[model samples]
Target chain A: MNKYIKLMSFLLLIIVTLTGFGLYKAQASSPYPELKVVTTDGKPEYIEPFHFLGFVSDTQNYSNSSTIVFKDGHSRYMEDQTFLERIDFNYNPQLNDFITDHRSFMRGKSRRTEHYTETEQHVIYTGMESDVYWNQPSRGLMTIAVLNKETEEEETFSVSLGSDGSYYEVSATYVNYPNLTILAATNHSTDISEQFVYTFDVENPTEELTETINLTQEIDSNGGVYFGQSFDRTERFIPIQSVRQTDDSEFDYTEEIIGYFAFDTQMQELIDVPLFEEDTLLFADNDKLYVGKDLGDTIELHEMNADDQNLDLVGSIEMATPTIGREEGTHYNNLFNQNITLLDGRLYAYETQYSDDISRPLFQITDIKTQETLFNGTIEPKDMAKHDSTNIDVFEFRLDTLNN
Target chain B: MKKSLHNFLKFTNFELERLSKFLFALMGITFIANLVGYIYTPMKYMGKINEYIAQNSATSEQAIQQYGPFSFYNALNSFWIVGPIALGISGFIFYSFFIWYREWFGKNTFAYRLLMLPIHRMTLFYSKLVVVFIGIFTLISTQMISLFIGYPIVSAIIENTYYVNQSLMEAVQLHPLFLYLFPLDLGFFLTINAVGLVVLLVLFTAILMERSYAVKGIVLGIIYAVVALTLVLLPLFLPDLLNNHYILYGSELIIIEAILLVIVAVLSLFTSRHLINKKITV
Candidate 1:
């Protein structure tokens, strides 16, 4: 009995001694670390601090309807009236026609179409007028710019536009040595009958072009031409031609997809491959081209040997479950909706489900070699819409092996 | 086999009878402490709010909004509530070692009588483990029942508007420790208890090592403990030794832990049986 009492007291003593040392260490150390704050203009400032919530994916223009509240009892409401007006216009065409008739009362403006071309270093924005007014013809204008993402430095590249027709479309193809930008233009007509193709060097945009391709024969009446990069980093001019047939009535016409032809820049010939509606091109490397297709409940990733153009079967992963709270009457397609990217021999797929109840975003990483799922987890974002549709824009997907 | 089973059951019941008074006292104290916390927290909070209202002429709603409503968070954070849990865990840890030591060190020399029983000595080790297991569940059940009983008394005192009330299951989910003890998933609850059983078995083997070697037994016990812990944790670090390093999934990690626990249990029982039959001083 005495020995039992001694053991009990000794155990209590050890526990108390260890707990006291722990408390002393905790008191000696600072609870919160010092935080460094920087202003938008790269200058440091000491100011009232606020906790940083996570960033929201500003996709589908949902940010316009979002509300931001600060800890200082200040709240800001964002209401995008233009987006509401656009939805209203789509639903009621008669109302749009009535507004268009009263051009003097309404703010009527000519419509312009813009194309965005993105590379690793630069984002090129080009806009062109679609319609010509009475007695006024649209002229072609082109501008080039260099944007450094790391330094946030932007400089306008010197450019000279020819006295030609209005530029309708622009395509950019990046290669190893000299990148090229192709511009297609036509005179004041809706039909692309007599079109001119002009190529410019991306690096030295100021230099005048010594050679021009008179592609009137190459480009058919209803055909579209675009520039793209092949799997081997070779620049190819792809022309998607269409066949048009007149119906019994002179007013009606029918157009069918003939085929897509790739014009090799170096070989100066066409490369032909069978095109299917289900096979959508996802990514291309030097020797292989990755294509994705929907297989009922799962998405199968297939690799096409770009050398021989033979398609081989790859593994598949299950598609995300649908949102529970989607509107009853609304027709929502849940096919090919996930964002998938292949980087460093690994595939990353992100799927977000949004309904009237809750929003959850799931991310998965799979190794391409083993075809095994390496990681699968949910990403929790602050202020996630609990009662509405969510759009998660994945702007960048990178795997940093060094940090891991 | 029938004789062994009968002796095992008899020894387990005897251990329970010996510790019943101590176990009941521990449970009573823990329950009273937690009950006091559950009642005092809301009363103290409402007093502060009333004082604030008297000084500033603030509405009850305004006061509730500014200084948040009485919640399960308040009850969980109360020192009285936490103190009982800490005390229970500490007492149990000490009792686990004491259960084996008491037989050897007691006035009546109980170890000699226990070993002299014409039964498999492994049954004796297992009987003590079963007693400890039953004690743990009883204490947890006592704490849960105390919370259920104390919650209504608190709610009756504090007005519905002044507090955010939760259901029994919701309150259990809100508390981190209670969520594991009374898990919603049956598999998770079983997994947690299985891990606890493995830890108890390891401690039993360490205690047997001490009883076998006497003065040199303390060092041997510590060394045995370190080696057992290292073996159990090898799976977690073994991947790093390979060229193609990969992380395991959650299910795979659980499987590895289960495998290691089995290995530890087998090794512990084997070593403990050898010490009991061959090297034990009694």
Candidate 2:
């Protein structure tokens, strides 16, 4: 031992220092202080089962971000010491599907919800494959993969887009057992884009039928079109919106919704939906479509009329425009797209409301039918001192249905 | 089996002793540089902020708003922070070659005595590999200590008002390069180190090839390294090469990669053992 003193001492130093550091880090548990959603008013049980997960980014250095989870009235770090552990914390079925199944993995994470759909009998994935080089004549092909859930077999095929125009995007996909419907937006050489609904058989996908929605005839050439939220695979209708940019100047511009049409996948026709006010928020969950108008003190939600396809008054819920500290100019707000999430007839509206005086993640859940505010709260640190150390706020939220 | 195990341990300790001075010097350089970075970077920032306040007649709040809050991550960006990192990396790389070559070229051609030992020649290979692995973890441990010591000192130097407290996890998130080298996640850390170990094995095998074949051996060594690296990187290229739109899942890709790593590692070790035992003319 004396002869090997140098080796022993060096080994001891490495082991002790590393072990101590590991124990300290492990004991610390989290970098940010523990946070909890303290309900100031309304029923807390409404949001008791749901876990809101999002990232808290440093406003000063946007690059530095941490995953935060608000659940069971308390907030914790979503990302832990391991990759699999972090995945387990914010578990998404789509993400889980991607890992477990090769077909989902090939379709990619971004399109896991929109361009992919799964039924009890069949799982389907679609994407637009186009030549990336702009100078060359682009060959756009619709790539499709269908998996039979019962047999555990997958059939993959691609159909060409006729060499006329490049189909750059597949916006929405719907699975109806034997038939798989895909809504793709194509960009032509003349700077005019077109939307086409491509329907295919799951067994023989090469046999394709495409219908081009004449958007050029209905709306202005300069306007852009997009599909509303179609998260559910069984959704029958995809709400399409065409908006033209109204530019007052180089900096000031607003998009005006010129045309709102619902593309019924079963009927194979576009039904015109009456356009609401320009500022109305449009979101669709499953087959039901709703437009929300923020009226300062209350948010008025109007659902689509089942018979006429016109938006009818559903009900208005109580809500206040979130403000920062008393010093108004020292705060920032970044509301995510489709901030209002309607799940099981319950509206979950959330956004990061930040201020130097009080930074909190504010969320309010309302029962759509009863027009009653079920849960209203702000996520904050247990200790005010903890809040001062790290400027933490939730950037997004999801219901804990997937984990359950 | 007991005798071989004993010889391996003895050789590992001997190799570790041989590299102790170099490793310690690197560790000291890393500690001092990181420590200075933690202190100097923030002090410099505070000086600039004070200068700004004096020049603009602005409050500390306004200055903080403009420059942003100073955190441990700010120190990470300083040029001084990379000194130890660069030294440690280059030292290990240079030593990987020198570890084998020195046995042949050093006083009394030490390779002859080492190979002539009663124990298996592969023990020498395993021992050198172990020392390299030890030296890397030692440097990592030293860096961890530096952070533990430096974070509080920096908090004091910058003062609580200006200092933005961040967890080590948050620090790594901000600077991704640290997460790759010194991952907090045990699985990730092991995976990264496993890759490093395989890479070292390949390099050692390449060095042995040079020792065995002389002039012709240099080209063979380069080819051998290229083949090993290509096999390791095959998983990444397979999707693109086959034009199959990433048909492989994450877990499958990882499994394939792990298998390839094991294969490359085993082949390198076996080839090295054969070269050192039979082919080398010492």
Q: Candidate 1: which pairs clash? A: none
DockQ values for all predictions? 0.01, 0.34
Give lDDT tens digits, candidate 1, residues B1-282.
788877876777777777777787888888888888888888888888998889989999888866767766567668887787778778888889989988978577889998998788889899899878777766766666677677687777677778764444445444667646653334666788888888898889888888999878878888888987888787766444431122333345567778988988898899999999999988
- Candidate 2 structure, TM-score to reference: 0.82
lDDT per residue as tens, model 2, A59-94: 555565577666665555655525644533324435
lDDT of each: 0.52, 0.69
lDDT of 2 by residue, B103-180 (tens): 888568998888898889999999999898889888877877787787777778886778877765466545666766
